[model samples]
Target: MTFTAMVAQPPPMPDDPGGRGEDFGKSSPVGLLVLLVFLVAVVFLARSMTKHLRRVPASFDPPAGKHEAPEKEVAPVEKPEEQKNGAS
Candidate 1:
């Protein structure tokens, strides 16, 4: 047998109960409205959660006795003067 012989024809398309694609949008207005409402709620919820999360800090304190020593200021180093023409 060949591939052509094994292939079957597709079923016929069903008749439209309500005039072609004319009622397509009419039937799903509620679904679209619900989806929009859900999307807006999700965005607002995420924003609120993010705002609250930012208020919390990651680390509470440094490890036991691992406290960093106080920083000290150091005087700036001075550069030697450049020699003039042929000076040893």
Candidate 2:
């Protein structure tokens, strides 16, 4: 009458070939073909990624210290003499 007694009972075995349940939980050839296709795609993708990674340059920045940048020159501004005299 208790749950333990119910659970202790062994599960019934599936009926022999006379029943339609014989093929239950079984995979077909189409499933195997799909799995193989996905595996092949993954392999090809991995190879392509490897090839692209190899083509990539290690550093995007230009070579350091190869070319020195020219120094900028600043010009001083001079006010007109008329404006300077008017302000004074």
Per-residue CA lDDT of model 2 for 2-51, tens digit only, reads 55544567567766645556587799999999999999999999999999
TM-score per prediction, in order, is 0.40, 0.47
- Against the true structure, whose lDDT is highest? 2
Q: Model 2 compared with the native: what TM-score?
A: 0.47
The deviation in Å at residue 2 for candidate 1 is: 36
Model 2 residue 46 CA deviation (Å) reads 0.7
List, residue by residue over 1-88, the lDDT tens digit for candidate 1.
6555566786665786465454554657788899999999999999999999999888788778878967899997554553443365
Query: All candidates' lDDT scores?
Result: 0.76, 0.84
Tell me the lDDT of candidate 1: 0.76
Clashes of each: 0, 0
